[model samples]
Structure formats: structure tokens, C-alpha cells
Target: MSATEHATCLAIAAARAAADKKAEHLAAIDVSERLGLTDVFLLASGANDRHVHAIVDAVDEAMHRAGAKRRTREGFADAHWVLVDYGDVVVHVLQNEDREFYSLERLWKDCPAIELPADLAHGGSRDGDSLGGRETTAS
Candidate 1:
């Protein structure tokens, strides 16, 4: 299975919002086959706490604009690793150090990449970005 069309669109919207907030790193993985909870995981990194907050806010707003009702938003108090969960797509806005330490991509290395917009790709590339066997395209 792959990420659904709606989930991919939501992920792209969230990714662009993260980019607007200057998220240092951005990636979206299709975890549909690997997990049952959500179809996509949109990962982003911010330089620090403030950056994380801004990214989270922007992502939340974008998701809402895209008509994604957030199920829950965690880790906002500390801003170390904020997770915005929409039923189909989960957005992770994290601090640079925390993002590196967790390295979620490595854990889900087998998942496919959800092709994102060119404008949203930023930061240095990681081995995990293309670790997936395929790249899923979306509208």
C-alpha cells in the first residue's frame, strides 16, 4: 500500500508551511504499509525552540487551511519535538539536535518517499530521504 491522495496533499501543504517558517530539513515518508495509524509522516527541523514553534504554528495553520482537522498536537510546551497529528498525516516539527538524535527516517527506512514540491525541499540531504525503494507522487 501507499499513502493516499488526501494524505499526500496534506503532507505537501504542511511541508510548504514548514519551509515558509525556515525549517532546516524537510521530508515526507509514506508509512502506509508500515503503520496503520497514519499514511504519511511529514518531518521537519528547526534551528531552535522558537523556530520549532513557528514551524508548528505554520504547519497547523496550513493543515487547517487544507481542511485537515488535527487530532492532537504534542510536545508544544518544550518545543523540542512537536508532533501535529491529523488522522491521515502526522507532522513532526523538531529542534535540529533532537531531529538528528532521533533520526526517525532510519527507523522507517523501508517506507517510500512522498514526492514533495521543489520549493519545499531545503537543508542538506540525508541518506534517509531516498532510502525508500520508491517515490510516490501526489497532486
Candidate 2:
């Protein structure tokens, strides 16, 4: 089975929250078939600990607002890789280097990605904005 409607909604909310905080490399994997523990895995990365914390806070708040209870939260102290489990959706906020090293996307490559909103498909605003939240232009 794939992600439930509720789970998809939660993931979308979490992704949007992450994006609003200028998170990068946002992706959502449907892990229901691979891992029954959760339906979706939402991944995002930040430049540093402070950025990671901000993304995490936004994700947590959004998920809660979406009616998902906090199941478990880990790695907030270091902010190297914060994992928030909300039963149906799990949000992962990681530092850029750590994210590259761990490569959660590579590990979950077999799963299909959730089609994020157009704005978040590439981690943030698509109208000439970089994934790092900086405006860019054709150079």
C-alpha cells in the first residue's frame, strides 16, 4: 500500500514548513511499502545547526497543526540530524554535509517520491530562487 491521504497531507504540510524556514533538498519518499512503521519520510537539510533547528521547529509546529501527534523526536540537541516521528509522517532535518554523507535519498531510491507542490518540488520558491533560499538569475 501507498501513503494514506492523511499521511500525504501531513507530509505536504511538513515540507511547506521546512521550505518556509529556508530548508534545502526537500524530498518525500513513500516508505509504506518498504517500512511499515511510517507511511512517508520527508527529508530536508539546513546549512547549519541553527538552520536545522529552525526547520525542525517549523516542521513540528506544522505537523501538530495538521493533527498528527508527536510520536518521538530525536537528535535535536546536536541538530546534525533531527528526526521527528508523527506516526504517519516523519520529518528529517539534517545539516548539509551530514545529509550528503548519510544520503537517505540514495538509500530510499527505490521508493517513489511524493509529488510536492510546485514551489517546494525543488526545496523552495521556483521563481528564480535557489534551493538555499537565495534569489538567482540566469548567469
CA deviation > 4 Å runs, candidate 1: 125-139
lDDT of 2 by residue, 1-139 (tens): 9999999989889988988998877878899999979999998889899999999999888887888899899999999999999998988888978876787876787787787776774444343322223211112
Tens digit of per-residue lDDT, candidate 1, span 103-128: 78778777877788776667654564
Question: How many clashes (backbone N, Cα, C below 3 Å) per candidate?
Answer: 0, 0
Clashes of 1: 0
Off by over 4 Å in 2: 121-139
Q: For each candidate, what TM-score against the reference? A: 0.89, 0.87
**Global fold similarity of model 1 (TM-score):** 0.89
RMSD of 2: 5.6
Q: Considering only N, C-alpha and C atoms within 3 Å, which residue pairs clash in candidate 1?
A: none
Each model's lDDT comes to 0.82, 0.81
